[model samples]
Target: MIKYHVRKDQAITEVKVSGHANYAKHGEDIVCAAVSTATILTYNALERMGFKDNLNVSVSDGFFHLEVLKPNEFLGYLLDNLEDTLHQLELQYPKYIKYQKEG
Candidate 1:
C-alpha cells in the first residue's frame, strides 16, 4: 500500500492507496474506485466543517479534485476531521491499511 498525506493550507487529508499497481484493467479499476471513495470521504468531511459549495466533484483520468471555498478558515478544521476520519477508517477496516501519523 502506498499512502500519503495531503495538506492544503492547514487542512490535512490522508490518502492510502492499496492494490496491484500492475494488473489487469479490472484490478486497476477497482483501485480507482477505492481512491475515489476515499476522496469523497475527505470532501464530505470538509463540507461538514462549513466549506462552501464551489464546484461539483469529479473523478476522471485517474485524478480527484475538489475546490475549497475558503482555505484559510477551514484548514484546521479539515485536518482535524481527517485525523478523526483516519481513526475511524482504521477501526472499520483494520486489515486494509493503517494510518501512520505522529501526533
Candidate 2:
C-alpha cells in the first residue's frame, strides 16, 4: 500500500509519500503509476511556478518527499490540490492508498 502523509506548519508544508501499491505486478500496477504520475506532475508544476528555490524534494524507489520551505498563496493552493487528488485516489483504492493530514 502507498501511504501519504501531509504536514502543515506556520509557513511551510511537507508531504511524504512511501510504499508501493502491491495491487499488481510492478509495471502493471495502475495505482502505483497514478500516484507516481501525480507526484511528478506536482513537482514539475511547482518548478514551473518558480517555487523551486524554496522547495526540497527527494525521491527513491517507492518513496517521495516534498517540503515547501516557504509557503505562499500559490504554494498553498498547489498543496491543497495535491492533497485533494491523493484523497480522491484513496477513495477509489482504499486498500492500495492511504492519506493522512497533520499540523
Candidate 3:
C-alpha cells in the first residue's frame, strides 16, 4: 500500500492506494493516487502525453483516490509526472516550499 499526505492552508488530505498479486506466478498489479489537486493536474498532463491508457482517475475536494491496473510503464511515469507537477505548483505558491530531506 502507498499513502500520501497533502496539506494546504490548514486543510489536510490523505490518500491510499494498493494492490496485491493473485500469486507469485502472476505479476504485481497496483496504482496510487495522491490527495492533492496537484495530482489531478499531473494526471491530466500524463493523459495529454497519451498515458493514462488504462488508468482510472477519481476525485473529491477533500480527498480522492484513483485505481488502475498497473501497467509496465506506469511507475516511472508517475514519478516523473509528480516531480513536474510539484515543480509547477511551487512556482505559483513559492511561499510553500517542498523538498525531500536526506537522512
Candidate 4:
C-alpha cells in the first residue's frame, strides 16, 4: 500500500510519503504513478516559484518527504492543494492508499 502522513508543528509542516500501491505491476501501476507525478511536480513548482529555501525535500527509493521550513501564506495554498489531491486519491482507493494528518 501507499502511505502518507502530514504533521504540523509550531515551526514546520512535514509530509512523509512512502511505499507503492502494488495495485498493478510496476510500470502499469497508475496509483504509484499518480503519486509520483503529483509529488515531483509540487517540488518543482515550489522551486520554480523561488521558495526552495522555505522548504526541504527528500526523495529515495519508494519514498518522498517534504518539510516546510517555515510557513508562508502562499505556500500553504500549494501544500493544501497537494494534500487535497492525495486525499481524493485515498478516498477512491482506500485499499491501496492511506493518509493521515496530525498536529
Best by lDDT: 2
lDDT per residue (tens digit) for residues 1-103 in model 4: 9999977564338778899999999899999999888888988998999999998899997999999986987887778788888888999899998985554
- The TM-scores of all predictions, comma-separated, are 0.39, 0.91, 0.38, 0.91
lDDT of 4: 0.86
What CA RMSD would you report for each candidate? 6.4, 2.0, 15.3, 2.1
Candidate lDDT values, in order? 0.48, 0.88, 0.42, 0.86
Q: Which regions of candidate 1 fall more than 4 Å away from where they truly are? A: 1-7, 12-24, 27-30, 48-50, 54-58, 72-103
Q: How many backbone clashes does candidate 1 have?
A: 0
Runs in model 3 deviating more than 4 A are: 1-37, 80-103
Q: How close is candidate 4 to the true structure, as a TM-score?
A: 0.91
Per-residue lDDT over 1-103 for candidate 2, one digit per residue giving the tens place of the 0 to 100 score = 9999988775338889999999999899999999999888989999998999989999999999998887788888888888888889999999999985554
Which candidate would rank higher by lDDT, 2 or 3? Answer: 2
lDDT of 2 at 25: 97
What's model 3's lDDT at 13? 22
lDDT of 2 at 41: 91
TM-score of 3: 0.38
- Clash counts per candidate, in order, are 0, 0, 0, 0
